[model samples]
Target: MTASIIEHQDLGTGTEEPVATAAPDLARPLIPNPQSSIPLSTTPQDHHIARMAAVALGLTLIENAIPTPLPGVKPGLANIVTLIVLTRYGWRVAAWVSLLRVLAGSLLFGSFLTPGFFLSLAGAVCSLVVLAFAQHLPTRWFGAVSHSIYAAFAHITGQMLVVYLWLIPHAGITYLIPIFATAALIFGTVNGLIAARFMNSKNEMLIHENNERHEIG
Candidate 1:
């Protein structure tokens, strides 16, 4: 008995051959898109808000300087506005405001080219960095007193560093520590009080809260 094996293949003979599915093109990252990174100031409202904040910051600095002594020692009354802006807007905006104040204040006081300008610039830069960091700290942990102390220390540190490194290269620069520390303590206390008052004030707190909510909304 011969056994025959039958193999059958079912091939569609009437239809066109099946098209092979093409592999998908790997999706590329959308990078360097100017539309995404470029900030569009298309609205007048944005301009108005920026202008108002600028004016407020400028006026605050001038007014705060009125009561300060020794040209560099003050309660940092302008910092109140800065703190507010830091909490309200952002670090970038706060930085801009701080820079604007320094530049404008320098020009207004006619110290644009003097040592005073450099000192102020140094102090402002240090303070902004400190405040930017402080803003992220827990409010209860630092509040105003601790923030003031830190800021004062940073300010003094920046000033003294500049003086030691650039202004006075002599070894006798260390002698100024006592004087600088005293000034730091006094100004630091004053700034603490100012900051505490500003932070604790019901009206200011309410305004800040409302503004924050508005921004979020």
Candidate 2:
């Protein structure tokens, strides 16, 4: 029967032709391939950016929940993650995380396409630009804390520009700069300290791991 089946498929050859069959695993049923099923391909970096963005988004939500005296003021706790990502990965990854957080947070909070959303986007863009320059500074002196302050100031500056140009469109808006600057300094320092501490801990853990590996070797 097998010979006859092969003979039937053998057209002009007049000889038995090999039959290709998919060997199905009895224990595992077939399903759509998770890898190729996607329309666009993704890389490890994409996933890493996504996870970091999620963390920032969570921080954003937490910051939103916290009551503040000022309307546009929050701790900016998410900046801590951005600083760390900048150091560990690079500017590109950090930018992705920061921008994604702004976009996703706005959508989540039902503020998409609103003035609030524009403010968030402006701040994020400014921070990312400042970080691009800040990253070029000497790492010895201008580390996480310095970068945090620069980015924070840039963030506020962007928001203020947006307010002056689009929203308020008056000289009176300039007066609020001092208030926003103060908030930036405070939050920047706090977030920077936290990020520095976190990075220090990670470095210590890596050193310990290397020592253990040397000992094992």
lDDT of each: 0.63, 0.84
User: In angstroms, how far off is 47's CA in candidate 2?
Assistant: 0.7
Sequence-dependent TM-score of model 1:
0.60
How do the predictions measure up, each by TM-score? 0.60, 0.78
lDDT tens per residue, model 1, 153-199: 77778887788788887879687677777777776667667656754
lDDT of 2: 0.84
The digit string of per-residue lDDT tens for model 2 on 93-211 reads: 89999999999999999999999999999999999999999999998888899999999999999999999989998998778889999999989999999999898997889999999
Candidate 2 residue-wise lDDT at 16: 33
In model 1, which runs have C-alpha deviations exceeding 4 angstroms?
1-72, 203-217
Native-to-model Cα distance after best TM-score fit, residue 192 in candidate 1, in Å: 3.1
Error of 1 at 92 (Å): 2.3
TM-score leader: 2
Error of 2 at 147 (Å): 0.4
